[model samples]
Target: MLRFDPKGPRKNDLSSWRPDVVQIWSIGEFRANWATASDTRVGYTAGGAIAFLDVTDGTLLRSSIIESNSAATGGGILCEGSSPHIVGCEIARNGAGFGAGIRSEGGAPLIQDCSIVSNQGVVYSAEGAGGGIASGSGGLVVSRCIIADNYGADTGGGIFLWPESRAHIVQCLITGNDTCWCGTFGSGGGIMCHSDFATITNSTIADNSACISGDGIEISGSPTITNCVVWNRIYVRRGNPRITYTLTKHPRSGEGNIVADPRFRGGGDYRLQALECGGPGISPAIDAGHPGVEDADLSCDWGLGGSRSDMGAFGGDGAGIRCNPCIQVFGIPEMVEYGDVLNPVILATNLGTFDALVAVVTGPIDTTIPLYRGPPIDVAPGDSVVLERELRIVPSIPAGLYRCDVDATLRGEFVSRGVFETILQDD
Candidate 1:
């Protein structure tokens, strides 16, 4: 029950905004045209419920809850020209002409700890998308959220990643959603991730029905679906042979996942029940995952608490081993730019037993150092080993911060890889 008072940002009223403060969105129907008015903008908003075209400065929507809200364009709350921080919010039953639940048509939204469900699009035709949230060229950070049970006419049942949008969905749940196509264009029933750099980590993306293709999840850009459990039928188009080539024939650099029937608990089970509870079997997928997770996130749920590692989030409570190596560079900023050479002594401590040949791979760049045996790289019992290798940065690397990995590949078995990101600098 939100009240969008008949108020407008008129008569030089934009001067009553602070850029550094946290804007509280207690009501909905929120809209802002900050792209046309820059200086008078808020930064963050998170707290109560809201509705309407909530026009304002920039905002950070954190810990806010929006229920049964609506807007002319952004059903619940439209993030058009203003930069907002939408953190810890509950956006449900909202509707937009374009972005049903949460729409970032012009600005970026750093969303976290939110639940987007049961939202719809007013003009939901075939070519539309994002039943939960949609962003174009916007940097989105969606973590620890649940995006489910939403309705989109075209595509993206739980969530959608369209062109030029960069998103990192970590520790999230995308399940039991529907994508119904009432018009002509239909794709990515569960999630249509095309032409974007997205990372799906430690998440459950299961039981999503799509009207077009990409039942559970689909990716076209440099997408890495690691430590995730994806279940749903791979859709096939009527006359498009491109779907087959885009999924199976794409040379991808990602692994450690389950494509089998992760038989969940029940037909209505969005919780992703384990195999013992009618889920994925004891295949090689168990205990097989990309070892690039943080130490704190290691204690996540692994469903049945089995040994080794399941190929998704929920690492079970028994996950005690932290694989990623800790780098201590005694040099410039605790971080470095994407392309900056360094002669620091690299250390590859063997947290595991036996012997290991640690490889110091390059930055976020695709080039790998190699698979070779170091000077008896061994840490007996409970100890650590250090290697003094001169590291060099590549110029073709990404601009922002970058990560360097240290891994062990014994006889090409692919043991573990520890990752560390470098600080990014501007030219």
Candidate 2:
């Protein structure tokens, strides 16, 4: 647990420090606290967690920054003229006027294998945009990431691409994001692209909501979308987008477009169903992608049909139905008080096809609390285990909402990580 309390601009100046790589591997958490006045204006402050300014190249890996608040922009991370490789990190529960998870301007940043979830936009201001990410005048590459459950006040609940920003989104899942405001002001619940140089491929944009229009994608420029599964509406405001080999609810004018239900695996799992595995029915999106592409297993549709790609995030030269254990952690309380003993029952579920060898639970990561680790247990596929532990809250701990992380490890490798908020009160 490393606490970063920035008093002024010179405190978190990474450009002056000039570190080659800023790696945070397996370190429980890194938090930044920079408080501001209530009447602070927008654009006055940025990067509630970190600010990368004028840095040419860097790497940020395997870190967790959560629940930070900014007065203006980039509540989790702010990149200005810096192209850093941010991978396998979690940026969630942060608040800002724009880009609640990240704000990139004038630099080509590569964001890969990260989770940007449950962040809030438009805090301390009336109109905010880009709850997950906001890019402006830069070339951004987002790959194999999960951007979900974010909220934006104005537009682009999942991602907002400004004019002249070239963003290439590939093999990502954008779901359950939302935008507020009604009428012509609000649009693009999944993504709002104002750039003509954007390209989206092999992605799944589903279950997004907007107040007025563009529940899946809103384009004001001529971007190209290919081999995607858009389960909602797509509103075009200005230029026409070249959409091909995609699956949507409405009939689109493309070479390989289909208007049908994707028959996704329910319970928030957006994978296309196959009838060979006792599924309800075969998904039309299975083996319905571009004719030139193929899955990572060198076969499409799991040997059920032709060797074309599937039309979703799980397809296209990536990990498609591999033998890996996908673990999920849950069951943490939301509130606690001082001098209270918490019997937190952490549940770990293996949702993958393979069996997890050994599951180990570690840490609650507080300054005043002693670290705890649970016993190891094996979890089979589609099975769950309850790691029961007792956490004692001392009187010396402060009273505020804090993020407590629980990590599951399998054979010395990280399987999954879960974050929960606990509000400590002075009873």
Candidate 3:
């Protein structure tokens, strides 16, 4: 864990941090005021006096920022005048007027794999925005992150966007944010957008509350929302927010939009699952996303490997796809004659946080051979699946290097694909 004392005895600058020459590191904790004596002073300004860390440029990776306090802006970290990259960081329990967790003022910032939670925004004199994060005219992009349980006094309990700014949020979970102090004008318990352009895709917004309205989101300008699951309400005060391919609790009219429960797992776990396996399963949301839609910020493949994106934060991995399954295919035949049968063996091991569903292997070599239809084979956590399936070769099949493209749909629609090579020799 690399700790940076912003108010070091010698200096208060980060000149010693060289992003280019430093080796790639994953810091566990990045406490700024761990060694400094607590100051009871009242006017602790932007980014806090001792706990603030201004990341004007470069990249921050795999770090957690906690217990920061600021009376002005950005309680934990401030990104101003320069672009920076933040990945896999936790910004929590911070307090500020504008942004309790992070403030992107004049430059773009890329935030991914992070959690901004339990932050507080106080509206003393000026209007408080963004309990978790605030973005100014400079655009920002957020992906694969969880922004939850933040509280704001005025607007945007989760995130706020300044006028003319732009933001792209993908595959994120925004939930449990509350805007309490704005008596009749509180907006966007999850997000408030006053920007010209904004886009939210393949994300989930749930359980947010506002004192006035717009419990899920409030938009002043036109924005595009696609393939998202909104469990609450939304308010568009000015321009229209074009929504498409979404599942919402209240019926919203748009292309491919449906009023259906996204079936997120309860008890504080919001991951989507299938109905057959219990819990409010998102059977309707799987493979129901916008076709050809891809989240550029997502590092891994989404859905059943068909280039189709899922609706919510969990994507199309189905119920138990969150459990990373270690699957291996072997014993593929090198050569086979027409009218011959080929047997392939598949071994799968579950190595993730939850139990994986039954393994079903389907293979139709080039859509010519009949597919092997099978039943669900449950693979418990830390257990393995030893599967053997047979494929019959038709005499009408041509001679060539035929590849058996195998697809395993675990749980429900969570698909894992593999290829087995075999040469079809003419007999």
TM-score, every prediction: 0.58, 0.67, 0.64
Q: What is candidate 2's lDDT per residue for 1-427, written digit by digit as tens?
A: 1212222244533343334433333334655544343212224677776666655433444445445555377888777766666666788877787888888886566676789998888735665789999988666677778999998878999999897776778789999999986455568999999977677888999999999789899999977788899998999989978889999988889889999999887899887777675678988988889887766554423322445788889776452134233322222334567777644433344433212323232234344332334434554443333333356778876777776555555445666654556677657
- lDDT string, candidate 1, 1-427, tens digits: 2222224443233354444443455333433221112211222221112322242333544555566655433455555443455655778887654566766543334455678888765453333467777765444556567888876677776677765665556557787677766545455666777633455555667667766667776555545455666656544322111121011112322343334544344565544444554555443334444444322332223434345445444542112213233322222233455555544333233334323444454544455554346333333221233333345555655656555566665445665565555566655
Which residue pairs in candidate 2 have backbone atoms (N, alpha carbon, C) closer than 3 angstroms, thus clashing? Answer: none
Cα-based lDDT for every prediction = 0.50, 0.68, 0.63
Residue 304 Cα positional deviation in candidate 3, in Å, after optimal superposition: 6.9
How many clashes does each candidate structure show, in the order listed?
51, 0, 1
Ordered from best to worst TM-score, the candidate numbers read 2, 3, 1
Using lDDT as the yardstick, the better of models 1 and 3 is 3
Model 3, 302-401: lDDT tens per residue?
Answer: 4532346668776732222333554544434456677775444444445322223232323333453323344444544533333444567787667877
Point to the candidate with the largest TM-score.
Answer: 2
State how far residue 22 of model 2 sits from its true place (Å): 7.6
- What's the lDDT of the predicted structure labeled candidate 1? 0.50
Off by over 4 Å in 2: 1-27, 35-43, 123-126, 182-184, 298-306, 319-427
**Candidate 2: residue 294 Cα off by (Å):** 1.3
Worst 10 residues of 1 by lDDT: 239-248
